[model samples]
Target: MRAEPSLPRHHLPPDRLAELVRGEGGPETLDLLLGGERSRRLLLLRMLDDATDLGPAWDLLSEAQRRAPQVVDDLLMYPQTGMWLTTALRRLRGRTPMDEPPLWVELGHMSALAAAALRAEFDFTIEVPVRHGRVPLPTLGCAVLPETEPWTRATVRAEGGRAVIEAAGAEVALPPTTGSAGPGWHPVRRLTVGARGRRLDIVLDDVDPYRTYPQPTEPRPLSGEAAAQWRRMLEQAWELLLREQPKTAEAMRRGVFSLTPTPAGERFRPRSVSAGDAFGGVEASEPDDAVQLAVTLVHEFQHTKLGGLLHLTPLLTHDSDRGKELWYAPWRNDPRPLEGLLQGIYAFVGITRFWREHRRAAPAQTAMAHFEFALWRAHVATAMEQVHRHPRLTPLGTALLDTLRDHCAQWLAEPVPEEPLALAHLCADDHVARWRAHHRRPAALRPSTGPYGHGWTGRADRPAPWRPNPRSCPTPRHAGWTAWRCSSATASAARTTTGSRSTGPRRPQPGSAER
Candidate 1:
């Protein structure tokens, strides 16, 4: 057998190498080792792979941080790992430019995710090693752990750089941090405030409470009036949202709807969001957050109440043949009731009302305005077709359908020139397209596909209609037949074409018998 070639020395297992480096025995153990850059790169990649397969690597980083805060510095200076380090730092602390010192460069390379996670756990910044040549260090402005105060008050003690928080018969251990051992206090320079209904909660980070709002002015550090103003704003926004709930609820029932509360600060932060019956959650961006939250709540709610009813219910399950087809369709196949269709129309009406009420003072119209119009047109078209095809409509059903059509027509006639152009065109186009697609399908025949080609097959022994006349029913505006009509025409044509006969009326329009 040929002698096996010697394995490359750098190909050592990552865990074993990491252990040597952590123990400060790596360089001495491997004489062939060149620089820290190569070793660090290999180590970091190993860590990353471990993180991907096991869980977030933050836990390992935290343990490393405790063992040696300088470990981060070493990794940052390590050439191969430096890029990822820089990426992580930027993600955590925001981007820092190159003109900054080498220390800043190393600091900038820190992972944002790591920082956020660590910040929640400890108060420590990695120090750059001076031996690695002149590297700049960026000063992280005053930052404090949000959980520190509560942890301290609860007689938190740290073991092996990990903190143990005991409160109300509950004991929780927290990892150790540089700050927890030092003054254990930082100034409160910023506040995160959120308001829900009448309740407003303020979180002060690295700030003195006596200086913040809800406290007497003299003892505080920052401008007391500013803090008080912020409190007032939070309260005002909360009140405004609560006051609008009734109208919001009504609007939501029509279509997708949402509500977002404003955050407490000069910059508008969204405090909370509620979306239809499906989903709603908070976001960090201040200005867009409030608007998006409100819109989501309203929009989703509309889907639940109005959109839900107009379509077929129990939405075909995955096992159903139609359900499989629905998966490929862009739109969901949730069932909707006639009442839901009306509700969607009403939602559009409500939107019009809302615009009239707030137009002059309102901010720019949101995308929701256009969305509502689209939903209204769809609901109206579906309802109209349903009414037309109901062989014998109930008195109430007929009245409702007629009323909705009249309302739609009135809306169409409105002098708001811009309003009619977009929606009317879309409605008309969609109506025609829907009819053509559905009416021409072979599966749409009334009884079944086998016996009929285009017209009805009345009975086995009896004759059926020969050719359907255009005059049999009024011409569809979009030239499409309803489901029932489509089925009838299909059966009749198929029966006549397949050698079956019909005794029904003859063709009416000139082209009725052609093709």
Candidate 2:
């Protein structure tokens, strides 16, 4: 039998960083992993920037880089900002963030900043050798944020071992000292929330927010009220996570370092993206309330945890031939793949439970809770049913589905109010019916007597061919019912495979903002 690979007890242990490096027990795993050289605990604390004093370290690193010059390379090589960027880039790319390119970017920026700090020059540039060519440090737009302007390219002119960056009609000055916070902090904007544990970093990401999502328009910086609202909601989310979801809180404490905030009303609500993004960091918008944000956190964390586990093990066999067919997802207006459906099942399990608990804690909000509970529970059940039918599910995937079903048992059984229950039933039935209509092949029709009991002949005993009236058929977006000219059609022909009467709410149009 193959034995489990032995792990070493080192400063940066392999186990916790597995999510960071997406370790699969490969030879390069140790090299790629963040922690054997730097202490994992210290690194997390520094990123969190709450418990320990990183100011001194930042100053020392700056001084070292100034004196030795090579110290900048050493500082940049360490995977501190790399960990947060790993998560951010993965989310941006919809895949694992490439290690080398981002690392190069980090090195260039750090070296440039170091050069700026050492000299008293208002403008200086540092060039680092990249894959294509020697790219200057501190490029106009951020690596993640894409922008356009009159000046397309930026160039750096080096003279007498000193360089200057010239771009877009203005010269940039050296950034403020790295005393407490500034420049050297790079990717993360750490804040002390004055909360217990002070574990997770609530980074107000300056660089990533612009590029994190495809903005409705160009993502300008949040203004006064909007920025304050974002910060307040974020602190509240942290407190709520610590209070309600202790397990998730603990996991996030270890894994997440960055929380990129966006303005409200973005497509695809706050989600933990980048499957192997171990930074536990998720991109979210400032919600109307902290309670909603807490729920979003719980839901997305489910995806983050599952994404990490899936990367390590094969939960479902890769099916390239699955084509582009979109399956029905009640939670979303758009169709989804089996994987997206599975993600919904697991996420809604937590969302339902959140409302289940909310039903007791806040009586005034119980109605809304009951509605969400019934809505998501029914939807998750429908999704779970679809999941079982997926042929690609591996044993691990089956196990995960079983666990989700188990988690949802309590919420599924809990009674909802009649109004919300009816609504939930209507919505679920409508979605399922429409889905079947779109996918299922119609059954062959048998000859029947006409409405006036007339057959093909004048004999009443014989049957007659009939077609459905156009006015009677439902629209394509509604029930997707075929318009047939039939004079004699039985009610049974219209019934669904579930024996459900083909009567419910009509399907909402695709862009009706259903979710």
Task: Give the per-residue lDDT of model 2 (tens digit) for 1-515.
Answer: 99999865543344543432221122233333323323442344344334323343355445655666544543343223344434434434457444434433433333433443333333333432222222222212121112133113333444454444444453333233321222212223355553666555555544432224222112233444665776677687778666656655665554444455665542223333323333244556566477767776666666555554454456678877553544556665445666776766665666676666665665545555555567677777666765663568887577667656655665578877676565555555555545444443343363232232222233334222112111122224443221110100111222312243432111111122222
Per-residue C-alpha lDDT of model 1 across residues 1-515, encoded as one tens digit per residue: 99999854443345433322221122222322323234444465455444334233354456656765665544333222334443334433445443322433233223322332333344333321111111111111122223322212222333334544343444433323422222222222233233333332322221211111111111112244654554454344334334454444322222221112223322211222211111111211122333333332333333333222222122112222221111001011122233333343333333333322322333233222332333344444443544333323344335445555565666444443244234434433343334333333334335444333323323233212112111111222233223223223323443433445422211101011000
Looking at model 2, which ten-residue stretch has the lowest summed lDDT? 482-491
Task: State the displacement of the C-alpha of residue 46, model 1, in Å, after optimal TM-score superposition.
Answer: 54
User: RMSD for each model, in Å, please?
Assistant: 25.3, 13.6
Full-model lDDT, candidate 1: 0.31
TM-score, candidate number 1: 0.26
* TM-score of model 2 (CA atoms): 0.58
Worst 10 residues of 1 by lDDT: 506-515
lDDT value, residue 57 of candidate 1 = 36
TM-score of each: 0.26, 0.58
Q: Model 2, stretches more than 4 Å misplaced?
A: 1-125, 128-169, 177-188, 209-219, 266-279, 324-326, 434-515
